[model samples]
Target: MPITEKEVRKIAQLARISIDDKDICSYEDQLNKILAFVDEMKAVETEGIIPLAHPSEETQKLRSDKVSEKNQRESYQSVAPTTENGLYLVPQVIE
Candidate 1:
């Protein structure tokens, strides 16, 4: 069904938009055209069409998961002000 000007105004009001009087007709026309296009699309036939995640059939190149850096925990903790059981101590700010 085609959208009416009154319905367009109501939609604008509900969406908290301030549309001009002349623009209501334009909005109504655009909305009606969209609905007509949707009606046309509904008539298309699609019996066994499968949906796809991507349009192209290319595979993504991936790298192997491996450790590339050496451990520096001891070197970092040596410079800390307070560390107990390999954990840094901080002043409590909340009660």
Candidate 2:
């Protein structure tokens, strides 16, 4: 369907985009072309085709779920300026 100038203005308003008076016709033409392409795509036959998330049939590979690092809280706290009972100390800013 060919888009009208009024419809294009409404679209620009809804999308919060600025459109010049000279560019309105250009935008309307582009939008009409896109609508025509969508209309053409709707006419294509897909009666038995199953919908899929991916284009390829192969599944993605994943690594094994396991813990690779040990907890070193004491070691990390040793490098801090002030630490007590495995916790870092910071100055109070708010009353």
Candidate 3:
């Protein structure tokens, strides 16, 4: 599960990242540590554990679905340069 400088360089090429040649050893060490941590996590036991979407069991609270704002479409559209059939009109940009 250890990462090497060659592997790091290959990963950088695939990810389109520019890693400095001097930082290759640093990146290789960091990646190896991450891989070792993943290997440690793979050793965990979860036979009877149920996957959960959230940490808490309580459901989220919701607000009332009733309308709270008055309709002002006509008032707002009045200032438009051109509008037709309750819809705004725009000039053609492409042939």
Candidate 4:
């Protein structure tokens, strides 16, 4: 099903985004294309196909979880604009 302007607006609201008037039509078109692709996939009959983790059989690298260095808190905080109680202080926005 093609997504309409109202549906786009609803999706924007649900995603907590402010979609501008100029971008609403583009968003609707993109959403419709995505839905159409999904509909096309629904028409395929894959009864016994198994899902694979990766396309190739290459192995991934594993890393050790041990800490290699201590926290450079004092050194890093020395360059900050402001600091208090071992924390970087930033300007407050709200009253």
lDDT per residue as tens, model 4, 1-95: 57789989998999999999999999999888889878877788888999776898878888899998899999999998999999878789689
Cα-lDDT of candidate 1: 0.87
Q: What C-alpha lDDT do the candidate models reach, one value each?
A: 0.87, 0.88, 0.89, 0.89
RMSD to native for every prediction? 13.1, 11.5, 9.8, 5.3
What digit string (tens of lDDT, one per residue) describes model 2 on residues 1-95?
Answer: 58899999998999999999999999999999889888877778888998787888777888789887899888888889998888788988688
Question: Model 1 — TM-score against the truth?
Answer: 0.43
Steric clash pairs (candidate 3): none
- Model 2 compared with the native: what TM-score? 0.45
Query: Where in model 2 is the C-alpha error above 4 Å?
Result: 45-95
Model 3 clash tally?
Answer: 0
* Residue runs of model 3 more than 4 Å from their true location after superposition: 45-95
True lDDT of residue 23, candidate 4: 94
Report the lDDT of model 2 for residue 38.
82
Q: Model 1, 48: alpha-carbon shift in Å?
A: 15
Error of 3 at 94 (Å): 27
Angstrom error at residue 68, model 3: 24
Q: How many backbone clashes does candidate 2 have?
A: 0
| Colliding residue pairs in candidate 4 | none
Of the candidates shown, which would achieve the greatest TM-score relative to the real structure?
4
